[model samples]
Target: MQTYARRLALVLAFTLLPLSGCKRTHQIIHHATSSEPDYTPQILADITPGHIDGMKYPDFTDIQAQVNNLYDMRDVDALWVKGGKPTAQADAMLQEFSNAMQRGLRPEDYDASRWDERVANLKSPEGAALFDVALTVNAIRYLNDLHEGRTNPAHFTFGVKGYNEKKIDAVTILNTQIIDASDVTAAVDAAEPQSLQYKALKKGLKQYLDLVPQDHSDPLPEMNPNAKSIAITAGYPALQSLQQKLTLLGDYSGDANATASSADLTEALKHFQHRHGLNEDGKLGSATIDALNTPLTARVTQIVDTMERWRWLNDDYQNAAIIVNLPEFELRAFEGTGNDHHEVFRMNVVDGKSDDDTHHTPVIADQMKYLVFRPYWNVPPSIARKEIIPHMQKQPGYLGAKNYETVDLKGNVVSPNIAAIDKGTQMVRQKAGTSNSLGLVKFMFPNPFNVYLHDTNEKALFTRTRRDYSHGCVRLQDPPKMANWLLRDNSKWDEDSIADAMNDGQDNKTVLLPKPIPVVVFYGTAWSDDGEMHFFRDMYGYDDDLEKTLNGGRPYPQKPMKAVTEKDA
Candidate 1:
């Protein structure tokens, strides 16, 4: 697009400058067109690349187009310099740069530590111009990282499809919102995600960063290899260490040195288990010890990484949507927007099994358009071929026992003969009834993943601590609750109507919602909610992928596999 981006360049010229004007040359001198920016405010003359700028800034390579447009809007004149000194706005921005860690950003990445020296060295017009240019570059970089993220979400491969949603122009926010705002800090703050979830993580990050350990504590004793649970007998070696950890985490409030009462120890252990994604049985098992041994700083890093993923979500959807956090096996429906958004409801969910390739739930976002009542269970061909057909071949009465039958491509009923099923000429489907695999209702959404939220016949699975037993689709613990809330605005449907539709031996039917609700299947190993921090099992090593990418540094791999669209075809 443009030539080489303006970088930090050295210069020697005028020593001091006036605060107001360097000399404003009016272009189209009298009445300006709508598109032209006011040249009257641009104080310094067009800066020469290296002759006007410093070592604090490198070439503005990452944000090429937006940076060009920002500079061009003011006709290459100095926007940061008024007289010879950095403006109050520049100071406000510089202060924010130093405090970037609170926003899960590295201050040094934006030249936070280097700004004061650069500002103090501004002696001539050359120095002033370079200072102005360097500030522009760093400010843009900081805002871009804060608004979207340091790296793109497409790099993490968390979603079924790369969730590289369109990013907002930080340059526009800088030009319009931050530059002349009465409150610069608030304006810069406004650039970040305003959702409650993001705020919770940020709060936790600040709290943990403040307490990040300088040195490691003595390691907890390893559990016996075959032991199922740690014994809580008096004077146990691991008990004291566990107590210390529990106290640090706010789980155990009593004496860290004293041997705790059996009941108190169990309760604290349960609290720790709940915060982590483990069975809240209060037993100090190996998994719990593993979670306990995890350093506080590691948790902070985990949170920072999760915050980066939040930037990938669609802004509108982030505020109000049904979000399923895979690792937590929970879905929360949030309503409203900004920090004021409240969780409408939440329910435990059964996500896909992770022990195999075909069953892992894919992360994605889409509109849940309708609900199907008494939906027939159209068994996927893979499942049919691997499990169903083989079972039926051995047990001739398996089809009848399981309420399954064969169907042709045209939706006509056919014999459950082995030949047709083996030849792939016919597909298997369970009848629409209470005993159907898809429980009594089906919530449909459009995505390439071919997954949906639905009621499941095996409701008992919800009782288990680990509920990843489904085949890619999400199984709701409380389908009736989900239906009632989702259909609250539809006059014809109430709790009774929804219950009636889900039962009564009716044929499979679908109800299109009056308005669609956003549904997002998400994966985050660490989350903060209600002023409490949560850490979950990696479940799918997504955390590993993200941590690797973050450590590998810049030019983050975006879209490891390109998304196909009609434009490409």
Candidate 2:
């Protein structure tokens, strides 16, 4: 028994000697080639906790916790290396990082240019360990940026609510998605948005990036501000320049040297007008020239801004939604997912005016619960105080002429008097009829803004290219079509029935939908449709605000939350 104990002691001493001091290198080398490699202690000793925090990584401060989790997953061992060399996964992810700009991300943001040098330094064990930590940190940052965007939407006062900003488990993603995948690029690509709109925007981003270099050397000359509208005519000095610019934009396919606006050029100009949200007059006008003269860089910024806004959107609602793009003055209802998805309906819409702060339409997302046929327009308090009461004071018969009535807090009928309004004892409401401000019907979502989709008495407003004439609510050009689409799945309501309900002339008849549909009041100034980028005027300076935020400027003032009230139908 004594002899056996002595032999056991000798074996233990020999085994621990290599790990103790000067012989540590032999142990490290042995473990590097062993089946169960365990160089975690050495790697952890080399990479201090403050190493990444001190590095110049974009958004590193924000994602420090994720970076810590990545190291913990591997028990503090090196990730991007094997046998003191950079792994194939590291090479592939570096390649992906280089092409980050294709997704509207800056390659410099990930320090992609320094990767080759870092990989070359991996000849030493300490260098390999440091490169491993840095790569892991960058990988996590890239995933976060690709998934939830680099900027926090809440910081911009974008009214983002009910969204949890999906937190990813970096360790699991690294192990299951990237490192063990057959195709590293495919895995990285899978992390991006799955919506068709996002894919289209990404394709558009690449297209516009390619156009930047081509158009930089030859910019469109600015048009004379006092120049009158030019039509298809011979002997025009600017005709050749116009042809050259229009042809570059794919709106013209005629000879660039043509001195006259031939039939082909006229058709092309009309196409350009249609693409640019202009009146298709087939003539060169100030507005058309301004759009043409907008710098290519500005167009690139528009695409990037739109892409950033796309990242703010919640991915859950892409399956089915009614999206009202305020700048475009358009409403689109999509049904299904992926290739199966198709636009079920589209119609012109009149959003709130942006000339004043009181009337600018807000960007929000909510679910439509029901529809109110023959709806009344419950005047908001702000409108009542500023517009209605003053008008009533001036014209005693104003309420009667406008089909408006006074209602007490209990919804009981009351006489219209400026005194009761001033005392806050009564409110004014327009009744349902052909002349009613809410036209015949209103779609309700019950948001804090008191905004909803409704038919309007002023249908001619939709014909305007820039339709921003509503009082914060959206005015649908074709309410009947919207009603039909909203009630498609509800057996209780059909097209004829919906029309009958709308014209029933009753006061605010509400029909509850069997299934609520999601509605997103989105604001995107630029988007791609049918392989062409469509740009709209920045109605509310949102693009400017976003650009300032992205450029590290002063954050926009957070909007004060208004108490939800029952108003504006």
Candidate 3:
């Protein structure tokens, strides 16, 4: 029992159940020609307090109650074992465990290859009981990992709110989906997101894995950090290495020894840059060099990490949803089911600066409640204290010069004196106009992050490839277009009215939408579009943080397996 328990903990950092059933001794029933053994007592004893049950409190309790509930409903009979052997459902689950990598999971985490030996050595009823318990533990863990990510998003405090599932549902799903299914693998796959975006990433995983070479020790030539750009002239020093790397990465199909003037090589460089969210100027710049230096295996890990984050999402953003891919600095609005979700419209966006801790655009799952047109930019207290107040103190007339005001707590405009602004007794707000910091419009949502999507006065910032210049709020490229889409349920507001409201002289006009449009400020450095995988720079170092948090515990053991002999069996 302790051996199986240790194996589970070494694999995924969690396991075991506190089952809710009987202490009745193992029973066997015989008919005229057949007999089936009841291993319920064996199951209960295997997951007992100090044996295979090494998980902590509630998690242990929930799974235990659920598994016990399964046997309780079956008159304390084991669900995965029949006649002292694993049932067909158990075999189906073993296949799911073996193909776990296909879904961006590690097969070893589920004891994939090790299962066969475990089953072959299950020559005794007690061994069969342990095997059954281990199977249940792995199955539940796989389902949870595939549904809600292996690494906890809360570990990094990204503010990504996820839907929590009760542990009891773990066995409920197994009973219905696995135990009563013809295609067990299909049932297991159905546990994940059923969206096209998820499917694209999943398919791209295989394609990207195929691009990895037998060995990746030989990397491209190190580029000069100070060099602005390297021209691909004839016999360029890094040209051969560049061509070989890109060719192996599937961005270049021609020969590695192709000339520097080879259009294929140039186009391949541009294509690689495009996929990597880099400036595709068809030149070897330092940024491009950094991306090229990133190992293919690293990119594969990024894809898997992206897949894990996708599992954190529920059905909220699937229909009539707005998604802001933080790494890409892009937004996509969609309104339909996965099969016909073609109503998606995309636009470039400017998110918060990644360099500052407080300036990151928080990852959130919420709803856009309304639109505020020609809105007043109520400056935050931190900004006022750090930036505006200092400027106001230096230039006494700076307040009136920019149509900014000092407003008291009672929602009344106060005297624009520098004394009150310096004292922090009053808040600051920029008047609604063309020169306002928020430009002409803002979308409001109910979130604790105090962030929103809005029009920005710094429109020129959008033209840059890496736009992260805001103070945590997201800046939209086309707020009027977003307004029109949000107001589609209302007949009074068209694109013309939307444009008029944003451009008019009206100060802070609010328009409540008919319904809440689900919005998610999501962060994924790797994404898939049109069946092509795309990678982006980790703007806020979240990828590194998530990776570290995931690897912070004991790693899986890589011990060789000795086949079970007849004597061992």
Task: Give the Cα-based TM-score of candidate 1 against the true structure.
Answer: 0.82
Model 3 agreement with the true structure over 12-62: per-residue lDDT tens digits: 322212232123211221111124554656777876642353221113443
Model 1 per-residue lDDT at 176: 85
lDDT of 2 by residue, 212-237 (tens): 67663243445576887777666655
TM-scores of all models? Answer: 0.82, 0.86, 0.86
Identify the runs in model 2 with alpha carbons over 4 angstroms from their true place.
1-61, 124-126, 216-227, 232-234, 254-261, 416-425, 553-569
Each prediction's whole-model lDDT (CA): 0.73, 0.74, 0.73
lDDT accuracy of residue 469 in candidate 1: 83
Output the worst ten-in-a-row residue range by lDDT, candidate 1.
Answer: 5-14
Q: Model 1, 57: alpha-carbon shift in Å?
A: 9.8
After superposing candidate 3, which stretches have Cα over 4 Å from the reference?
Answer: 1-34, 50-62, 82-85, 113-117, 160-162, 165-168, 214-217, 255-261, 416-424, 553-569
When summed lDDT is taken over every stretch of 10 residues in candidate 2, the lowest stretch is: 553-562
Question: Which one is best on lDDT?
Answer: 2
Give per-candidate clash totals: 8, 0, 2
Give the TM-score (vs. native) of candidate 3: 0.86
Model 2: number of backbone collisions: 0
